[model samples]
Target: MIDWKRNFLMVALSQFLSIMGFAFAMPFAPYYIQQLGITEPTELKKWVALFTAAAALTLAVASPIWGALGDRYGRRIMLLRANFGGMLVLSLMGLVPDVKTLVILRLVQGALTGTTTAAQTFVSVQSPHNRSGVVLGTLSAAVFSGSMSGAFVGGLVAEWLGYRAAFMCSGVLLLAAGLLVLLGTREEFVRPVEENGSSMEDRARMFWDKIGPATPILALISIMGFVLLFDSAWMPLLVQEINGGIKGAAFWTGSLQAAGGIAGFLAGPIIGRIADRISPPRIGKISAFGAGLMMTVVGLSQGFWQLFAGRFGAVFCAGGLDPVFQIWLTKTTPAQSRGFVFGWAVTARALGWMAAPMASGTVAWMFGLRAVFFISSALFFLLIPIITLIARYLQPAPQPSAPIHAGRR
Candidate 1:
């Protein structure tokens, strides 16, 4: 009776809006710190690292809890919470009195807002399992497309109206997204009877038990998440360096990210379809190698256009990494426990996100900005062997043969 296609379309639309809202102001964070009066380059870098890591730290802790709650309560509610929470936090971010206040808000943002994870879990629960690759891939495309639109428009908004205005616009978009989800999507989530009397400890143990078999895949997912985002916080600074000043730096950073978003938008569904047909491990290996190569080019680039070109290629290939792994995870895990497992998956990725800024910040602080890109490239290459080793674990389980009747034609 559930109209899954309609549900997917609605969820995808909400996801696009949600990610667009976040991207509007987030890519401009380092510059926002400057507006908050941290002009010293070292101080700026340190604060940037802190700002980026703070959210990841809390999200890492909060995701599994939210995920479990999604299963117990309803995925739709969790999706709404994420969008609405982001709307509030991001709006407040534009009004922060100081860098510390902004960082505090960022921490809150992480704890409350994980729209991507929430949306993905919601869609995963609703859609047919066989179509997971396409469904999730298309959802990822929405994310990339949203990011593309957000970054492009946001750059111009920041350039003309200033960073605060960009944050305000982000809030409005999230509000719209939340409303869309609230009114448009439907989830017939039946509460699991066993969860009613389960204590917190019992729930936690059950969650782990479901997730235990997928530990190896989740571990790689975490590492890949770190590799994917490792250079993100420092990218704005790199653009500044390339541009040779603050003038138009915000626009250029947004433009560069927008370019990558464009590539990711195109790559997501294509790579996803391919992943559905081919072995995800094989796709992962190829994507990782290409991403590493492109990242190296990005690191060595001397100008804005060169960086843009490299980023486009890198994002195109790197887009496959998450969706492919997600497809693999869906295939490996039990259906009923997906929400809990995915929450932990978000936690694993959050851990990676948490570590990336700190590590990249240290590298940029000690060596230089370009060094961070090189290190990120190396990490991408490292995933190749890891993916190969895990391919066995990710293989689809053998099916039982149909029993033959003696005289059946």
Candidate 2:
């Protein structure tokens, strides 16, 4: 048997590096776009929103293909492909002579990126069952570490150095992540079953069959996607709420936003085990809905402490929600279709992600943050009743007896 523990560390580190590299530009990207010559702050904000939307849309399209390919070729090779491709794009971003080129590259980068998916495949395919949650939780922390590193540095670096320099920093770090993947990782594709293994195509089909029956799982995932929307929109606005000035804004925003990831990192695994005992659907019915409400409360808070408390609650709930969601995805999904089913969740998350920020920020700007929060909170509360009803009426889907199949995409 392979030493799953040792491999999980390598996979986690590689993922962390990849994510941190991506985060390097997130907090500062808008300011950089404006500084690079946009001339209007409002336009810059719009442009930033556009970039966020583009990333979500592109990821929705690309994630399934990436997951599918990992199954066809192998996870480690596919990871290298993602890292190298992303590295090339980020590095070239530093050299782009025009703002338009930079914007185009940013859009392309989102389409090509698959850091989290790759990491999940690595852990799921490699780690033993009992250790999956712990290993994945550790990996989540690494992603958080990367986000923290990138955001904090992006803030400070953007202020001190030029935007070009910041891009260069992001590029160099991404290159390093690719290098780590190429040098530090190896694949050991675990067959879903010993006899009569299903083709990747078969697995994809099976995944879709369950998709309708997997309402609870999909709903939880869809909520996660929506949370991404809240997160992408709220984060920028939250920084402004903390401090009005756009300058030095990214540093603080990025830092605190990353703090949520840190909290999730620590909390994800612990919660996963707890959820396994209780069931992920039950946890999601509570925590996913609670995440939305608490975050809405954060938006409504008047002062720093109130905002902080709300943020703390939201992050805590979010931390609990993610691993539970992942566990539900794993449990509800059969082994053969696991990666592909995950891709669907990623797709749902991306699609919801596309809608959330665009609607939240655009509406919030006109209606005020409190009104926006109230709206979101109302919708969140509605989910509680919906979930309660689903639990009361829905029948459980059958788990794969021997790693059933989902036909190729």
Top candidate, metric lDDT: 1
Off by over 4 Å in 2: 39-42, 96-99, 190-216, 301-306, 369-383, 386-409
Q: Quote each prediction's TM-score.
A: 0.94, 0.84
Q: Could you give candidate 2's per-residue lDDT for residues 1-409 as a string of tens digits?
A: 5676766777778777788787777666666666667746466556666766777888889888877666656677767777877887877877877677876887787688777877787678677676666666667667767877777777677667766777777777777877877776666676454233289877666555746556566665676567545655545555666677677676666666566666666666667667656755577668767677786777667666666567656776766656666765665555565566666677877887787767776766677655656666665666566656666655557777876478734
* Clashing residue pairs for model 1: none
Tens-digit lDDT string for candidate 1 (176-269): 9999999998888898766442688887777567888889989998999899989999889988888998889989988887898899899889
- C-alpha RMSD of candidate 1: 2.7
What stretches of model 1 exceed 4 Å from their correct place? 195-205, 393-409
Worst 10 residues of 2 by lDDT: 188-197
